[model samples]
Target: MSCSECGSPTIDFSLPERYRASLSTDAAVANCCTRCLTVEPVTDADTDASTPEFGRISDAVPTDQEQAIPLLLALELADSLATNRDAIESLLRDVERAGADPLLAIDRLARDPDLEPRVDLERRSHQIEQLLYYSNN
Candidate 1:
């Protein structure tokens, strides 16, 4: 089924029996939109519970792989830079001079459109926020 938020195709997954009982309705499955990440419970009649759908979205909708290109590029760059101890030290010094936390600097780099133009930083802002929260904890 399509997502009500972004109209992107949704991936369906079966809810465990324990969790199913908590819901008022007898929905054994839930659909999560791959793009917007919106999740909603779906009954068996709304979808085929036997086989969960995957990779059946329209061509116009960007696939997860396509959306990950910028992240991949950023990760590759970070990995390559990690091999250079001097570069890492220099980056640390720069961040220190700017009076910014190293982790926040990394988050800013990830969200910088000029650095990774293809990345939808706005859409992934929550992920960045979570990363910061977890790292602090």
Candidate 2:
């Protein structure tokens, strides 16, 4: 990865073992862009036992909350960084699949420093419920 500030290559960080265990599937990984210092998410399908893992990267970016912001931001980042439409769309679905509660989405949209959108929080919440129902199929 490249730095957002100077266009230099960026570094990556990983989630710790304990935190990874807290996640549902441990199928996504976090990366801090070197250029922008932004936290980026990548699906864990690309990962293997050879990949490095760690605890949370920083307190400035904690993973304890059921906040939709992380999932939303990760989706957007995935779209922007992805190579093709198919890949981007896949990431979008993942975002919708993994995001937090509608209330959390609303709260983040209302207060996030990045001004991310959460307008459809109620509808999306309902969508998630329905999706979950169908997923049981």
Clash count for each candidate, listed in order shown: 0, 13
Candidate 2 TM-score, true structure as reference: 0.28
* lDDT of candidate 1 over 28-117, digit per residue (tens): 776655554444678756665445442332222223322322222222223333253333344344334545444443455445433321
- Give each model a TM-score: 0.35, 0.28
In model 1, the runs with Cα more than 4 Å from the true position are: 21-25, 44-46, 53-137
RMSD of each: 14.7, 9.9
lDDT, candidate 2, 1-137, per-residue tens: 44343454433444434334223336445454322334444454554423332112222332433232343333333322324334333333544455534334433333444322313333444444344344443
Best candidate (score: TM-score): 1
- The positional error of residue 131 in candidate 2, measured at the CA in angstroms, is 17
Give lDDT: candidate 2, residue 87.
Answer: 36
Local lDDT at 25 for model 2: 32
